[model samples]
Target: MTLSRRQLLQAASGLALTIGIMGLPALAQAAETVDIDELMKPSPLGDKVLGSEDAPVTIVEYASMTCGHCAHFDEVTFPELKSRYIETGKVRYIFREYPLNQPAYAMSMLARCMPADKYFDGVEIMFEQLRSGALSGTFLPALTKLSKQIGFTQESFEECLTNQKLLDALEAEKTRATNEFGVKATPTFFINGEKHSGALSIEEMGKIIDEKM
Candidate 1:
C-alpha cells in the first residue's frame, strides 16, 4: 500500500525518536528569509553534481530518500531534467541529503560510502528500491540486500551505517539547510538561488530553467 503523507511523517517521527535525529516540526512561523548568496554557497558535504560546474543555471535539490514526492521526481521529472538541461550543459544539478528519518539517513550514508563518482548511482538504486516496494518491509534487510547489489558486504554495510564521522557531516549539512536555507520539506529546489518547495513538473521546471537561462 502506498503510504500517505501523514503516515510517512509519522513513520519518520517514530524513527527519529529511536535514532536521536530531530523530527521535522510544523512550520509554526514564517520561515526567516535567508541570504541568497549564503544559500548558493557550496557545501563541504561534497555535491553529487550532474552537469558542468560552470553551467549557467544551477539547481540544488534538498531531498529525503523516504519522501514519496522525491521518489516521484527521481522516477519522473529527473530524466527529462537530465536530458534536456543537465546532459546538454544548460544546468548544473546538485543533490543534497535532507533525510527525514533513520531509514533515509541510513540510505544516504550508504550512498555516501561509495566512491564519489558512484554516489548518484547509489541514490538511483535506492530510489528504484523505494519505487519497487522493496523498501517497505523489514527496512534493514531490504537495505542490506540493496547494498550487496552495490558491492557492499554485510560487514561494510553495517560499518557504513555506523560511521560517526559521515553521520556527523550529514547532520551538519541538514542543520545548515534547515537553519540557513529554510528547507522544511523534501524535493526542495533552489534554481538560480530561488527557493521552491515540492515536486515540480517537467513543464514547470522547464519554465524555471528557461527563466534562469
Candidate 2:
C-alpha cells in the first residue's frame, strides 16, 4: 500500500529539514555554534543518547534515514566512530531524527517504535537495508520487513505508524532542531556545539574530536 495522508503529510513538512546536497565545505561557519544547555533541553520524543555522561566530547548527529550521505556515514564511519569514541567512553553520542521524506519519517517512527534498548541497533538496520536496496521497494512492505527484523508484528507495525501522538512528537523534534540547533540537513554534526554539515569520515571527525578532547 502507499503512504496514507498522515505519512504523506510527514514528508511534505520535513526540513523546510532537507540538508542541501553536498559540494559545500564540511564544517559550518564559526558563528553557527549553539548553547549546550539550549541544545540539550527537553524534547518531544527525548534524545537517543549513547555512551558515558562524563565523556569529554559530546557528538550530536542529526540525520535523515533516506539521505545517501547519511547512509554512507552509517555504513562507513559510524562503526569506527562508535567503537573508538562512544564505546571507549571518550565521546557521548546523541542521535536525533531529521527525516527528509515520507519513507524517512516513517522509518524514523519505526526506529523509535523498537524497544528502547534497541533504538540504535534498529537505526543501524534501517540504514543497512537502505544500502542493500531492501528498503527501496514499496513502502509498507519494506518497512514491515524492518519491523519484523526487530520483532514487530504486522499489527504492531501498523499501529505504531498510525499513532498520532508519536508522529506529532517526531514532527516537533524536527521543527525544534531547525529552529533551535540550525540543523538544515541529514548527517549534521555538532561536536561540542560546533556545527558541521554533512557526513564526516573517521579521520576527519577524529581530528575535530581530538581538538575537543
Candidate 3:
C-alpha cells in the first residue's frame, strides 16, 4: 500500500515515522545564509517548479513528503501562495526533496516518477494524503492502488520505488542542503536567499515577498 515502499508502510514494515506535531515556530529565528545562484543549482533529477520565472520574489523550499508541517502548509497556505503570488506573477516557487527517512525517500520517489505534466499533481496527492490521514491506513496494499489510479501498475510502482538513480539524486540534494545551506528541518524556506525555518503563514510569506519586490 505504501513505501518502506514508506509513511504508509508502518504496519507492513513495522517502522515508526515521527512527524513534527510541534506548532509552527515564529519566523524571526535565524539560520546560515545561502547564495541564490548556488541555491538554484539543479540536482541530477532537476526541479519540480511552479510560478513565473520573471517574478520579483523567489522561494525555494526543502521539504519532506511525510513531514506534518509540510503537509499542513500544502493543505492550507500553499494554495493562497499559488493564487496570490505564483499564479499572479509575483513569485517563483521551487520545491526540492529532503526526505527524512526511508518511507519519505520512497514517497519522494513516487512524486518524481510521475509523468512530466503530473509531477505537481503527484506531489499534491502525497501532501493531501498526509494532511487528511489517508496514509495512516493500510498503505502496503494501497501503494499500488494509488499508483494505478494515476497510470502506474504494480510493476511500475515497484520499479519507481527501487529506482536507485532517482533515489540517489534526491539524496544528493539533501546532502547538499545540509552541507551547503544548513537545512536541518522539513519545510525550511529560503526567500530571496534569506533563511526562515517554519511552516510560514501567508501574511508572513507575503511580507517577505513584498520586501523583495
The prediction achieving the highest lDDT against the true structure is: 2
The TM-score of candidate 2 is: 0.87
Task: Extract clashing residue pairs from model 2.
Answer: 14-17, 19-185
Per-residue lDDT of candidate 1, residues 1-213 (tens digit): 222334433443344222212323122232233476787776667778789978999888998887877878888899999999999999999899997876887788889999888888889988887777777756766677888999898898878776767777777888899888888778788888777777788887898799879
Instruction: Give the worst 10-residue stretch by lDDT in candidate 2.
Output: 15-24
The full ranking of all candidates by lDDT, starting with the best, is 2, 3, 1
Per-model TM-score, in order, reads 0.83, 0.87, 0.88
Overall local distance difference test of candidate 3: 0.78
Off by over 4 Å in 2: 1-31
RMSD of each: 7.2, 4.6, 3.8
Least well predicted 10-residue stretch by lDDT in candidate 3: 1-10
Clash numbers, per candidate: 0, 2, 9
RMSD of 1: 7.2
Better of 1 and 2 by lDDT: 2
lDDT of 3 at 23: 27
| Deviation from native of the Cα of residue 114 in model 3, angstroms | 0.6
* Total clashing pairs in model 3: 9
